[model samples]
Target: MTALMKQNIRRITTVLVSSAMSAFATVQTVGNFSVLSMNTAGLPDFLQGNDVPGDKTENHRMIGAKFVEYGYDIINVQELEFKLNLGQDFNYHAALYSTASLPYRTPTSGGVPFGSGLNTLSRYSFTDTTRVKWNDCSNFGGADCLTPKGFTLVRVLLSSSPEGYAYVDVYNIHADAGVTNADLVARASNLRQLSEYIDNWSAGNAVIIAGDTNSRYTRVRDEIRILTRENGMTDPWVELIRDGVDPTEETICANPTTLSYCETVDKMFYRSSPVLNLQAIGWSYESSRFLQPNGDILSDHNPIVATFSWSLPASLRQSELYGGPHDTWFSDTGVLSRIFSPRISTIRFRGGSRLDAVSVAHVDGTSITHGGTGGRASELKLTDGETWTEAKLCLGQRNNRTGVFAIKARTSAGRTLTAGSSTEDCAEFVAPGGWGIVGFVGGSGSEIDKLGFLFAPH
Candidate 1:
């Protein structure tokens, strides 16, 4: 009787797991409405004195138009002080702050306020906005005393409609640049405060807190760990990448194409609320493409974009278990399993296109679907009449490479499995500069397995 009871439990668990897999096959298909988040490449140069051809207002208009073209609903702007005519041209509602004039300090090189750092602009009507003041406990009586800058928080309500009010809170931080250790600690503290504030204000509402949180060193990474583990906010960009959506872009760099050492400093964080369903998050060089034949690095930082669907389950905010220090793949497999991780894992797709008609096959069966190309935005799913098995996956792309597709599965024994690009390549969607697929196989295998392929361009 005990053995029979155990068998029944095992069967139930298997059915539940299979149902979840089927649901995975249907990801990103929900109610249509969505909201997106992005960092405003950087403030326009009239603010920075880069000596381009236009006045501050004109320059802002040009850049503002470019930002709008990217379809960003909310934008966080760093170095707001550098832009001479900062807010004159942009039509969106905005808030700006800086620490430049904080007591006991010489003006910043760019002449923006110190401590008074990050700012934000938005297309949707913001119900209210406020800045969290910095602590001035440090008093270096010297002629050039270094005063600490306070982190700034901007609260924007998405709507005033009686629909119970859902809002995304934006917390922007520009920590100390050169000093590695101290900078991370300070930034972490600021992030904790921001997270606490959001948690306090909206409790269970959808919350998105983003900015340039510089977490590189071991110390900073530790703080980030605290943020994720304790605060329950997920880094959608990182999570999506783990799910096979390479949304990273070369944002902070000494020069274009030649990336600097400190990449991924800028990031977006999402609260795990059922209301805040992160659909796709990515970065864009769309504005950079418009740069005149002349050379200018748009803004020093890259713009990170996150798309959210209102109906996605809260589970979407839970980071998936893959490709990390303590990931599920770690204990289960070794060696070759390591190669299964993406070699050149993160690359921001510049062109915004769509990948159409892609397919995926599990050990049990197969299915198909589609998504945008370029950034970590590609889509594929089960076709029909086929349940997924252990190792088989087939995907085809139609729109050049507008999207990205990744693979995840479980063996019959219930061991979780993860891997890199699928064998199926998009021979069909191959266009001049379009969308397509990068496939992966599920089970323990050696050698490329071609499920199928598709191609398209926009």
Candidate 2:
């Protein structure tokens, strides 16, 4: 019962939907960023060359220099291949070393053509790319939908913090391999058209689904708890398995040919909106380190690496009285909060214009106003048609209940609209775990000085 569990038993189709019971919510551990997903079977029936050993293009350049020796800014791969003229190759160095990419191959051919077996490599700088080929794959991966396996979205950015600019919105998939019946209806139409093409995008941004999920979590049909409780996403080694992932190797190489299989189909999930907070989770299963000078084990699936730490609504803005979030009521606790946490996305509040509209409260004061005739009960105008430079807010309020969040900014002609509070509502909005976008700036005294947040092409 090996060979990747014989690609999941052969024939089973149920679409279960029950798994993710609830557990992982203890975030914050200290991390900057890193992510890597691999399935480098190096397709075209895995170029059998000497039946798996050295020179599989030097084992894909030693697996792309061991993912740059595990530095990883972003790298998702699948069978990967593309051949025009040794230009821009990819996925295990462009399909098992035909050329141009992988482990660390980006000599320009990013135009992505030739064979394109789902490849994404980055050191940062990403955009709105989207690709999902599979129409209705045949069976046992139908030669992997003949070269366009499926799944990719991009977003990336990942840095520049003072309290913002750490974007992410990567999807990267590889579904549709077994359980017959046309591979369970093309893996449920690749999880319902990749959750309806990321459901029109913008939920407070910041998502990272990861890949190679040949569907598990107690199968049923590998609905995978409908993408973690209806696309709320967050698996981190199965719902934060007692301090989730974070392993370089403490011995648990569970199975997949003995290097930590444990039902390995390759997965890694993340989501935020309860105001950004997946601060830690680590992993590495480089299949016992590259090897293969004929020693073996380089790509038959076993790249699996992960590491992350997020929770920086601008490094936790202090909500001011001197340290933010004081709110002394009528007595005026200095009145200047900046709580942070936005994980639903769809935020766009560019430069600034007349200044004065930036309020969305909930440190118990509850706010999300602007329904009609100058609405403002608990406060939440959120740039009500300010047309300042640009405005649009959609913080995760579908049932708001995370913690400490305030966004006060009002003082146009009264003077101070140019001092501090650039209308980004006090922070704390993570917990959606699927959408994408994250960036911020928290410093300015009153009239709202330079504010930010984008990823809302919604």
- Top lDDT prediction, candidate number: 2
**TM-score of every candidate:** 0.44, 0.31
RMSD of each: 21.7, 21.8
Q: Write the residue-wise lDDT of candidate 1 on 227-296 in tens digits.
A: 5666676766566644533333333433333331334556666663432444444433233433433666
In the range 293-314, model 2's lDDT, one tens digit per residue, is 5556767666666677776442
Model 1, poorest ten-residue lDDT window?
324-333
Alpha carbon deviation, residue 130, candidate 1 (Å): 1.6
Displacement of residue 401 (Cα, Å) in model 1 is: 54
lDDT of 1: 0.38
